[model samples]
Target: MNSFTQYIQQLFANEVGGLFAAEPAPLREARQKSMDFFLAHGLPTRKMENWRQCPIDGLVQSDYRMQREADPYRPVEEYFQCQVRNLATQMFPFLNGWFVHPDAPLTKSANGVITGSVAAAVKQCPELILPYLTTTHADKADRGLVALNEALFNDGLFIYIPANVKVEEPLQLVSMINTDDNLLINNHNVIVLGENASLSFVHCDDSIKYGKTLINNVTEVHLAPNAVMHYYKTENKDADSLLVNHLFVRQQENSEWVSNVVTFNAGYIHNAIHLDLDEPFAHANLYGLYLVDKSQVVDNQVFVAHNAPDCSSYQMYKGIADDSARANFNGHIVVRQDSQRTQAYQTNRNMALTDEAVVTTHPFLEIYADDVKCSHGATVGQLNEDAMFYLRSRGIGERTARMLLMYAFANEVTDKVTIDSLRERLANMVERRLSGELTLCDQCRLHTSDGKVLIFDVDPDKI
Candidate 1:
């Protein structure tokens, strides 16, 4: 067994009971079950099909503390803040996997919405969130990493929207890491949108101190009939950070889920999403954009299950990898035998700016149903020579032209962002990232220069 696995076993036996001894019975039972599962499966290996291309060697080698005392000297806001301009959101702050706020840990809005820390919800309003808190989601299957998160998670964020209500402002979650020592952090988030409700949410992940840390995070979302949800995620960190994230989403009749994930920087990042369309006319639109340079690495794995007729799912992922960086995308769509009239499409495209940079894409479809329209495709190549030449001939510099093309390619996904202010902010960030301006920390140990904003105009007809 891996030393980390053995450590987990001993940790569970020694502290699992004590961790939740004060919590209610259901919470204890749920965590115990997850601990038991992890003991049996251990950490997922590269031999596993879903993990074959991703390596976890660096993750397990460290003897990180499972929990740590809250850092009194670390000022998180001094290190990182919301970069989205003019995006009005009810912001919640998380420092080192625990939600830190001056107000009550759990609060109810005037509009009958519950938003705050997940751990506080369990302690304060158990009856309100009990049904979904510790229960198994039908659309989700177990994974060793996700089990690890469930077994060890202490605090995160929770957002609940009651039936038939529309939230005016988006809710923003900032998951920030700034530590003086190497540590392990596990947290879970729960989002529940009731029938006929609609809301927009944004999640940001950033690192400030550049200390080595392993973040194992999980999120579960439940959408009732006719609900509409817009979700966005951003990750930017130094090279010393390792992140593993899992999301389980379920949609009911006539519901819609629109999600955009953009990764600007990270040392090692893995994002896995499991989506289930449980009723007819449900639709999911998933998009992602990533930029990696140096020796950085990123992996996005998505699975969409169509369980009802007339359900539709779409996925588009694009990334740029430079230097010796690596980017991987794996998307799988499954249409059940009973799910007739299912429509699913997936596309992955990447730009390998250098010969040493590697990008791998796998778009798969499994259709057990007879009446289904499904297609999957991937492209791995460099910048379009014709477009580059066109720009150069029009008196544009090579570097600026290159950024323009890359920006144009990325706009396809970011343009789909529903929130207006947030969309504009993302566009600016993308430009800065392509120009080498964006960094989570003021100065990354592996990085030297910061980025500046530059405008590149391209005539659509000429290009």
Candidate 2:
């Protein structure tokens, strides 16, 4: 075994006893099973087909530490106060892999909805969470990574919405890593929506300052019959971090699920999204927008399963790769034998700004039902020359014209965000990111996160 594997084994050997000491028997047993799997197979490698395009050799070779205690650093107000103004949200913050705040870790709404730490949920109501924990991991391709996360995760968010209840404010989970030493962090979250329930949630990942960290995160979402949910994720981390995220969803009869993933900044990012339509008339949509440059890497894997008749799903992902950056997209849609009249479509489009920029795209459809309607396609090229010429002929500056096209391309996905306030804030952020001028702002600390603002010589919107 390599040094990273040996280090992890030794850490588990010394800490496994106390790790599950306070948990119930089922959770403890689950962790043990996961441990066995992880010990048998280490971290994922390029040998695996699902992981060939994205390599983790650097992550496995680096030394990493696990935070064993909750150390609430002083002056929390000074460092953690950055937030989008005029955007209303119930914020749950995490620092250095542990949930932190002056308020209680768990909160209940007036309608009996519970939002809190997963550790707290395990302590308070272990029985309620048993059925949904790792229920879909049996078929996942990266079982080793999922197993490792389940075996060693520190803390995560748990959101439960009761039947017929609706939450007006969006619940935001913001996790930031701030440490000089290299570290490995795990986060496992579960969000359940009961029958006829409605909710809007936002998950944001960012870095406050310095760190060479590896974050192995997994999230499971369950939607009952007639339930409606809007889930969004915003990722903007430093260039020194590697973020791996796996999202699993199970949709029941007549349910509706929509999600938009926006990646503005990161060194290396891998996102795997899996969804199952278990009942008829259910709808699922997955949209993503990624902008990377300067040696950054972003890889996305999307799988949708239509198990019941009359179910429909759509996937649309777009990216802009510049300099020596790399981006990849793999989308697979499967229609089972009994699933008739299923409607599924997949499209991936990318723009490579330089010759060195690399892009790999694969869109596949496996159908067993003859009556189903399915189509898949992918395109990789530079921006449209005719469109650029049209803008330039209208007296728009060349730089502004190019920026406008990129913004318009990205705006297609950003416009899918459901929350009005959050959507407006994101629109502004997208514009700033395209212009590469975010540092001009002195009022918002978000300027320091990663990207810039737009000061147009001649307004392109008017043109």
- Candidate with the greatest lDDT versus the true structure: 1
- The alpha-carbon deviation from the true structure for residue 217 of candidate 1, after best TM-score superposition, in angstroms, is 0.4
lDDT of 2 by residue, 1-463 (tens): 7787788787777666776577777777777777777777777788877788877765554488888755664435454553465568787777778777565677777888988888778877676676766353734445677888887877888899989987788888888776777878888888999999988888888875557888989989999999988889888877878888989899999999998998887678999898999999999999998888888889989999999999999888988888898898999999999999999998899989899999889898999998988988899999889999999999998999998899888888889887776776666677877777542222222222344432223222432
Once fitted onto the true fold, the runs of candidate 2 whose alpha carbons sit more than 4 angstroms away are: 73-78, 134-141, 438-463
**96: Cα error in model 1, Å:** 0.6
> What is the Cα-based TM-score of model 1?
0.91
* Best by the TM-score measure: 2
Minimal lDDT window, size 10, model 1:
441-450
